[model samples]
Target: MGPGRIAGVVTVPELAEGDRLTVDGVDLRVRVSARRRRFALTIEPDATVTLHVPDGRPAPDAEEFVRAHRTWLVTKRAIRERTRPVNPAKRLVEGEVFRYLGRTYRLTVADDVPSAGRVRLVAGRLVMSRRAAADPARGREALVDWYSRVGYAWSVGRLQPWAARMSAAEPALEVRDLGGRWGTYEPGTGDRGVGLMCLGWPLFQLPMRLVDYVIAHELAHVRIPGHRGDFWRLLRRALPEYVACRAELDELGRRLWMGEIWWGG
Candidate 1:
């Protein structure tokens, strides 16, 4: 309040270190990253609160920001948690439907569903060997493993061209549960000049065309790490309709994450 009293301060949100706090009985987790340029607060579907702070920001600033946005956080958590898919196979049941590679398949839970191989596709149905139809968690694990194996194969084919054209080394593909990220590209010169990419296994549930878009996106990151400037240019040249594919994937992803909502058997 010295030089310009009326228009005194200009601030941008950002984070420094990560820690947890409790405010008004709501638990908050704060994470700081130097790469982040602004402060962000979010509530995961599990109702966990997270505050992202940039490196240069003060800790007190983050605490105050969280306090100011408490109401919005609570509201958002309520909405997201209400729609979150239950833990493991909480939503899976007999005759439940799921999508894989863009095709709808019905879940058939049986004691002898057969876990020796991938989930059986018989007569357009996904036969789940729940081992007495009781351990839905194991069932989900088996299914995810199967999807990862398949995604590895499909992604290799989809990503090869980009690797070759860019004259860059092909990134090693890793299929796993990447939390909420669609895909991640870890640059080379860190792991012996070999790039590593971790793609969320759930993406295998979408159409190959959409999956191609994600592959292209990550491949684009091989040369450009951040989503700025040349990144868009490279992506546009690879996939002109990336925006539409992203929208479709987001919609399908929301339903797919539920793990049991498709209707076509």
Candidate 2:
């Protein structure tokens, strides 16, 4: 994905309609899709500038139209710069800040023999205890292990009963690692029965609502097995606010999985 940058000031009087003007900032991609008669600004995880016009209107009139929305352009550019991604590597050290449950938590590292792995509180604060870090691979293992266990436990506790309530085609439920997709549902195949594969560590950053949306979406597939109206209806029934949850997840996905992880040399 390209970085978003502030486009100083764009004014074109000849633009009519059905035209798009995008100002890419260092952190966001802002675009305006315009038409002859009207326009609206789209801003959230992805910034979009849009306009509408009558069917017969010329498609090139957007340049002139955008001249009217210049105030919005400047405001949005400032917002994009503020929302730019933070370096995750810097977040690994003590005194750094990270967000969890809509709150900021400072990192605190210490040594605890019994409950000795890295853990986070409901407030999203990190608690790291003293442990062996013989090599880089060990550090990576420690990190992945902590993230996976927390993500898995949190997911299973929430999903088990929801899965039961949603699907009657199975007796037992299972969880595994999923790649490329957030989660998947498979009907009984053999002695294997029914199962779910949730991708690694995503639950850490994704809100509970989004995780539930994914679980319901994939579980709905157990019955529908495809993207059809019925599947959507089921998903909607399970998560009425699925749309917002989906948007939030998409935003988190872009941030979390975008960086590199170095375990060791």
Identify the runs in model 2 with alpha carbons over 4 angstroms from their true place.
1-87, 97-105, 112-124, 130-136, 168-180, 257-259, 262-265
Specify the poorest-scoring 10-residue window by lDDT in model 1. Answer: 256-265
**What's the CA error at residue 56 for candidate 1, in Å?**
6.7
lDDT by residue for model 1 over 85-173, one digit each (tens)?
Answer: 45233344677666778988887876664454346667888776656235555666767776788788888887778677555568889
Error of 1 at 212 (Å): 1.0
Q: Which of the numbered candidates is closest to the native, going by highest lDDT?
A: 1
Clashes of each: 5, 25
Off by over 4 Å in 1: 1-17, 20-94, 109-118, 122-124, 130-132, 165-168, 189-191, 258-265
Per-candidate TM-score against the hidden true structure: 0.67, 0.54
- Assess candidate 2 and give its TM-score to the true structure: 0.54
lDDT tens per residue, model 2, 27-131: 222232332134434344334434443343332443444556667776975675566444244334456454432345665655553565545453455665445
